[model samples]
Target: MQRDKAYVIKHYKKSLDWINNLRGLSEEQWRTPIAPGKWSVAEVIGHLPPWDMFVLNHRIPFLLTDERLPKGPDVAHLNTMAAKKSREQAMEETLNDFISTRRQLLQTIQQWTNEQWQHSFKIGQSEMTIIDYFVGLINHDLHHFSQIQNVIHV
Candidate 1:
């Protein structure tokens, strides 16, 4: 089912607000792992932007056109690369990159015509609306956000 654009946008905004809560953490806090053998908070922050960039540059464009949706990159490889890059950057820099990329995505989405929001795109054998794509994005953000929160609380 197609979700209302306004409702999806509201949830997206709420997710951003939750991410903003990370602003006050110190550098060490940002780098702390949520659990052994898991990603650190900065790496979790690192993990997010590539997907937003993909949605902005690839998925959204494909949804607006007749182009086949591209297969996603290998998750483990992508996350490993992102984690390495995140560790190399200053915590604040990594955080800003994620926020900036996400904001750009929001701006792009806000400009979409109602029809664009309702457009269906194929992913492998399944299909989903543009709003469903946004829902997936929000779910992704929350997943990492929860990881950060859990690590910080430890």
Candidate 2:
């Protein structure tokens, strides 16, 4: 199997598992602040859309066709900018959008050829193999999920 695809698919399953586990949450719980000076659960979930759109659509194709990365829209500040919209959204809508968007992203990833798994990309000024990029995304999910869980029943 392609190494990057295998690793990313594995973790995407885990990400789905994590989201499924949250099926019991109350709306209030989903809206609870997940981190200090950071996103609420809904906002963090909302953040997935653009990243998935970027990676599965733009980055992979761009790297394969021209070997270039997105050069603008400071990613470090992205969550902050996006969280503003989340704050105005209904929790259920945001969660549904996250699940729907991620499912589409996983589907796109599954279509990639073996060479695409080795595609080089840059995320926030860091260089990475496609495998590393997917791993990092999985790790990012875990990190934020932990924050959500910590705030869930408290």
Candidate 3:
């Protein structure tokens, strides 16, 4: 993939449209579970913001620095924490946080130089570019969106 600004912006725009589809869902719909052991639509939606915040605060900054990047955060643990926090929040509030944090991340990304987008962040013995990192996040959003759609339609 090219992994350019336009590509990243496309994903960001698509995310907003996808999220808009969740608006106005009934309280019951929002609370619907994906499967027997899975998180509800609300909790899945709530899980996204902090990861974006992490991208903005920790991942991106560490990558921008010339210093060696540390190991990635424990995503499973973060998700567990985020899901628990979301479980107590209203659907509207969680959705709003998702929208706000995503937009903020997008805005921050929009200002980056091409070099920054192409900059490689070391992970273990390998490296991944900033744009690649964002693509992973986009996939993460889509994964949750699909989960929400499946549960909502059931």
* Most accurate candidate by lDDT: 3
Model 3, C-alpha of 140: deviation from truth (Å): 1.4
Kindly list the per-residue Cα lDDT of model 2 for residues 26-121, writing each as its tens digit: 878777777677677878877876677777666766655545676645686776766777778876666666777788878878888878778776
Q: Return whichever of 2 and 3 wins on lDDT.
A: 3
Error of 3 at 147 (Å): 1.8
What lDDT would each prediction earn against the true structure? 0.80, 0.73, 0.81
28 in model 1: Cα distance from truth in Å? 2.3
Kindly report the root-mean-square deviation of model 3 from the true structure over all alpha carbons: 2.0
lDDT, candidate 3, 91-152, per-residue tens: 77888898899899888888898888888777677678887877777777778777777777
Q: List the residue pairs that clash in candidate 1.
A: none
Question: What TM-score, computed on C-alpha atoms, does each candidate reach?
Answer: 0.88, 0.80, 0.89
Which residues of candidate 2, in runs, are more than 4 Å off?
Answer: 1-3, 121-127
Q: Number of backbone collisions per candidate, in order?
A: 0, 0, 0
How accurate locally is residue 84 in candidate 2, as Cα lDDT from 0 to 100?
Answer: 74
The regions of model 3 sitting more than 4 angstroms off are none
How far is 150's C-alpha from truth in model 3 (Å)? 2.3
The full ranking of all candidates by lDDT, starting with the best, is 3, 1, 2
